[model samples]
Target chain A: MPAALHALKDFSDIHINLVGNQALIEAELASKSFDKNRLSITHAEQVVDMDELPSKALRNKRQSSMRLAVNLVKDDVAQACVSAGNTGALMAISKFVLKTIPGIDRPAICTSMPTMKGHVHVLDLGANVGSEGESLAQFAVMGSVLAKAIDGNPKPRIGLLNIGEEEIKGHQRIKDANSLLKLIDINYIGYVEGDDIYKGNVDVVSCDGFDGNIALKASEGVAKMIGFYLKAAFNRNLFTKFIGLLSYPVLKAFKEKVDPRRYNGASFLGLRKIVIKSHGGADAFSFFHAIAEARLEVQKNVPALIAQEVATLLTPQVIEATHNEI
Target chain B: MPAALHALKDFSDIHINLVGNQALIEAELASKSFDKNRLSITHAEQVVDMDELPSKALRNKRQSSMRLAVNLVKDDVAQACVSAGNTGALMAISKFVLKTIPGIDRPAICTSMPTMKGHVHVLDLGANVGSEGESLAQFAVMGSVLAKAIDGNPKPRIGLLNIGEEEIKGHQRIKDANSLLKLIDINYIGYVEGDDIYKGNVDVVSCDGFDGNIALKASEGVAKMIGFYLKAAFNRNLFTKFIGLLSYPVLKAFKEKVDPRRYNGASFLGLRKIVIKSHGGADAFSFFHAIAEARLEVQKNVPALIAQEVATLLTPQVIEATHNEI
Candidate 1:
């Protein structure tokens, strides 16, 4: 609430709708200062438990904060919605209420990753499990459209994440997807191994949700381990601790550069309306980043752009031509 | 050549058989110092390209240096073999020459990863691509055996890598493998996510080669990205540069803690004989780590231990009983 109120104060042109349980939110809101006309709270009857199954959430919790939040977008009261709720539940409710873009088969969970060059967006980060060639092809189109729309990259390099870069490597599904990618309208880089995601040469890296999720989580884990190691080393002894104190500003700057909060929001790509999923464990700063991302999504109109691109690219004729070229 | 020669000197009690093209190696070795008795050279007719297909190496490069090195182990002239050559060719040739442990299905690339508590061993790190439930189950058993033999952990906490911790989560294969893991005679922790690998809660994390390879490489990429970010931050201005210099010792200590070299030396586990794989890009310190790993393998007799475990664990009756339990 503090971070959102702070950010909302700065984003004077943008208004906020605090949608959640009414009594709980009103009690919390009483102590906060805001532009009365700019911010308002809406009542929600229920909360989505972090561990609740998506099916249960979808079936029973129709008036959940998650669902109500999405409903705001659907009802044209909001351009976008951001939540640090359960992913499966958020995905289910968002898909159920907002629906997917016309040509999009299934939505993909994409987030920005800080890389050596600058950054790259990776998609299907555990959104569509067991992606086949067609869905993967859709993911590519959605990712390409996203890169073009959000980053303003006219010709973004899109790569398929795989075990090995060789066409002969990986499983049948990826191989089929590879052939399809080669014949696509986008600048499809053949195939990228894991390191390529951080190399920052490509604009978007797409993979099966399972692989993408593992890679994303593994990267986070490794970064966390590095931080832990650095802290331990800095506090080892008096001399090191002195050095650490002297270098505190530089260390803080470095930490800020790689903080996960900067890349906090993940787009639920393929949704007809913009919906962002924040990390479940996000703090005030991170959640503000999520809000900033939602603001970016509305500014960019990423979903509408994807729908426009997919209309031309996802036709039966175009798919057939791609197959014939392969 | 310099790195090898430098590392060779430090490994005084351990002998190294340098196998490569006769003239090139001879010219390179002339200036390097070593304990003459502990170092020897063997000429091989061919070298494996980094891109050479494993099949081509196996069929046509019979006298390749890679083959010659493995042959030394087969002929009992060496206790173990260490190669920083092409992984596929090394795996193919080693499997052909030494074969697998009696009850082992295939050899897996197992390596230790630095974690919060200490380090944990992860297996099928690009060795067994697209593994089935049975193969994954076997990988668990092999990993369990490795921890007991190599680390002297009486019972290791072995976990199957998955997108989520719930048994009801992940794909069918992982779910099937989980049931099998439970029935087996090892400390099989239920599904562990990517972050769990670094939490140091589990001693062994087993995954399909595709996911395992991605997780491994993604971790490396993230670490590299962090280093890049740190360097970029430290070099941003004069004040930051001064701080970086003052903190040099502590920074160096931090670097050493997570240095890739310290975690080098992946074991080609499941082979009948011990075969260690140095990273293809390994330097003196890293290659030496691989040599140290080989020494440890010889001391622990990892393959023999795994064979014994598999003997009791993989009998038809036992497998059938496990299937029945599942």
Candidate 2:
């Protein structure tokens, strides 16, 4: 928190409103110097425990820190909200407070996946499991619009994530979604397998939350495993230790480029307002990255862009085409 | 092919039967030196294409090399079989030919997940997607039996792969499977997440084929991505390039330890006979690893062990308990 606050000093135009227990936040800020006008705090009555069920949290913690932060976005006091809270609870409150964008059926979690070329957007990473064809199509368009708005890449190559790339492969939902996508305006590549996520060829990868969540987390697990093995290998003997010392700079550069913190923000796309989710276990550096990401989305007006794209998506031509294809 | 053949020379007691197009197999083996008496070949009329649909290949290609290899095992000429072919076709034909072990409901694809401690077995990588609760429980028993037999752990720690560790966290399939696991005699440690697959604390991680396939492929993608970044970083400048040269040995050792080839074989468990599924794109070294893995499973009689454990798992008391819990 201190690191994030200190780094915010350079962003002269951005104002931050901290919502939490008033005294604790104030005490943490006491030792730091800042532009007092740019910093403010809102008192919240409680904090939602990470393990609490989303329904229970929604019913019991109306004045909780998470809810209060989201309310700022709702009241237009803030253009965007950022939370590193319980994902389900945060998602529930964000959807309840801000609602979905016009023509959007459900909000999807979209995050940047680091790849060889750069990064591509993937969704919905645990927001909606066992999703139907219609919902998945919505995610594809929402993700495509996000890429256009945020990455300035129009006609992003959108792919349906599947077990195989063949036309007849995968369960019915993907095949149904494939038919719907072909009728839409977005650049719909038929299907891509898991390895395509990092290939940098496809710009958007869409799948149900069950597969998406596992793909995201499993990728992280493998990265960490490789890092551990690399470290262990380098520490084996005096010669290897010397080699590690010599290669420290190269390794550090490599780590920075691939670090998850560089891609900290996960957008709750399809919502009326932008809500960026920082990893729950994120540090001050990662939180700062999340704020920076949220700032970018605000500048681009991502929600309005999605709402506009979806309006076009629902026009008679595309809708009739979708109907015919389905 | 040459490397695997060279490695097989030391294991002289084990004979090798190359099954494929006669001309192609002979041409490839002409330059390789092995004990001629120990090597033989079986000519097949057709080869199953990698992209062919499983049902199509099963129906159209009766004399395909895949069918002939499995036929050898059925004819008692071989104790086990290995294939680096289309997984769907392989599973379909293997099930058609060998059938499932008594007390086993279905065959699962089990592969070793490289972890910090060494490796742990993860099951149903892509065999039975959208599995029921009963099948999931059966996977647990079969996986535990294989772990005990192959890894020599009397009581292998088995966990249901899930998005969360909490009892109420995942879908009903996982919750139902959790209840069934508790009632069964396996060492069921409740739920584990994607990271737990690499944690090395648990010996067996069980999941439906959907999540399991994504997780496995996603992990591989991450490793490849990291390797790419590492190479790019080291080649950025002369100083880093020099460091890269110095660190080459250390890096090679690290890569060897974490290489997917070291953990290549995937077992099609629950079949009456041992059948290993090598990664379709695996090279000679990786195919050798698959053959080596098959040898271990054959020595352990993994299927019979699964049948015996499942015999206990299906006892009237356990079956009644399972019925009541779900």
Candidate 3:
């Protein structure tokens, strides 16, 4: 509630519809000052628990805050929806309410990750486990569109994530997806290895949810491990500790540069409406960044652009040619 | 050659047979001081190119240095074989010459990675891509034996790498592997996410080559990215540059703590003989560490232990039970 209120204060052009128990929200917002005209509350009778199954939530929690937020988007009362609720439930409710774009088979979880030069968008961070060639191709297109919408890159270099750069490497589905992507109008680069994700050469990387999820989580693990090592190194002895104090400002700047809060929102692309999933443990600052991400997606009209791109790129002939090649 | 000569000087109990051209080996070793009796040379006329396909190398390079080195291991002239040549060719030729332990489907690439407590062993780093339930179970057993041999942990905690820890979360093959692992005699700790690889709670992490390869490479990418960011942060201004100098010793200590050279060798587990693959671009120190890893494996007789474990754990009843459950 505070994050939304803070965002409302920061972004003058945007309005927020906070969906939850109205009385509880009002109590939380009692002390915070904001433009009441720009901030409204939509009372939701229920709330989705973090561990609740997606199917059960979809079946039973129709009036849940998550569901109401999606309803607001569907009814045009809201241009976008941002949630820090259960990922599975949010995905289920949003997919049910907003539906997918005409040609997209499934919505992918896309987020930007820090890289050498800037950052690159990666998709299917655990939406589906074993994606086929056609579904992977669709992820490529969606990721490309989102990259274009967000980064303003007219031709984002799209790379298929694989174990090796050679055409002969990886699974058959990757090969099929490679052929399909090559036929698309987008700037489809050839295969990229795992290290290429941080190289910043490729603007977008597409892979199955299994691989994407593993890569993202593995990167997180490495970051945490490094942090653990860095702390231990700084506290080794009196001299090291004193040096750590002198290096504090430089370390602070580095931390700010790679802060995860700045990249808080993960958009569910290929949907009819913009839906952003913030990290569940986000604080007010991080949540505000997610809201800001939602505002950007809404302003860019990402879904419409994706719809147009997918409709053109996934024509009958392209699908047929891809199948034949596979 | 210098690394090998250095190892000969350090480890008084071991001798080395340099397998490349005699003239070239002698020329490189001319200035190096080592015990003459501890070093010998075997001349080979051919060399395996780094980019050569594994199949082509196996078929055409019969007298290559890689083949001769493996032959020395097969003939018991050397207790272990370590090569800094092409990974694929080394694996292929080693598998051809040494074959596999009975009941083991394939030889897996196993290596130790830096972790929170100390380090953990991860297997199938690129030996086979799409491993089935049976193969994954075999990998778990082989990894378990290798961990025991190296870490001296009688019953090492074994984890199957998955996208999530929930039984219902990954692909069907993972579920099948889970059931099979549960039935195995080793300390099966169930599914672990990518971050668990560095947590150090699990002694060995087993996965199909694709996931393992991606996880490892993704880790490398993150490490490189952090290093890049750290350098940028220090070079921002004169004051920060001064601080970087003050923190140099601390940073150097941290680097040594997580140095890649300290964990250089990747053992080819499940082979009848010990084979270690050093990084193709390894420096003298890194290559020496690889040699040290091979020496450890030889001292522990890892292959014999793995073969004995497989023979005991993979009995007919166990296979039948696994097949029925799958």
Evaluated with lDDT, which candidate comes out highest?
A: 3
Interface RMSD of each: 2.0, 2.2, 1.9
Would you list the clashing residue pairs of candidate 1? none
Give one digit per residue, the lDDT tens place, for model 3 in A131-249.
88898999999999888888999899999989851323788888889999998899999888888999889999999888998898889888888888998999999989999888888
Error of 1 at B27 (Å): 3.2
Docking class of 2: medium
TM-scores of all predicted structures: 0.96, 0.96, 0.98
* Candidate 1 lDDT: 0.85
Question: All models, DockQ values?
Answer: 0.63, 0.58, 0.66
What is the C-alpha lDDT profile of model 2 across A26-72, one tens digit per residue?
Answer: 89889888888888898999999999888888889999999999999
Candidate 3 pairs with clashing backbones: none
Superposed model 2: Cα runs more than 4 Å off: A165-168, A315-326, B165-168, B315-320
Query: What are the root-mean-square deviations of the candidates from the true structure over C-alphas?
Result: 1.9, 2.0, 1.4
Every prediction's TM-score for the first chain?
A: 0.96, 0.96, 0.97
Model 3: per-residue Cα lDDT over B77-144, one tens digit each = 99999998988889899999999999998999999999988989898888888888888889999989
State residue B119's C-alpha deviation in candidate 1, in Å: 0.9
Model 3: residues with Cα > 4 Å off, grouped in runs: A165-168, B165-168
Per-residue lDDT for A1-326 in model 1, tens only? 77679778878778889889889888988987788898878899899999998888899998888999999999999999989998999998999999998878899999998888778999898877688877787888888887787788899899998876232377677877877777668889878888889988899898989989899989989999999999999999999999888888888888887888989999999999999999988898898888888897888888988888888777888778766765
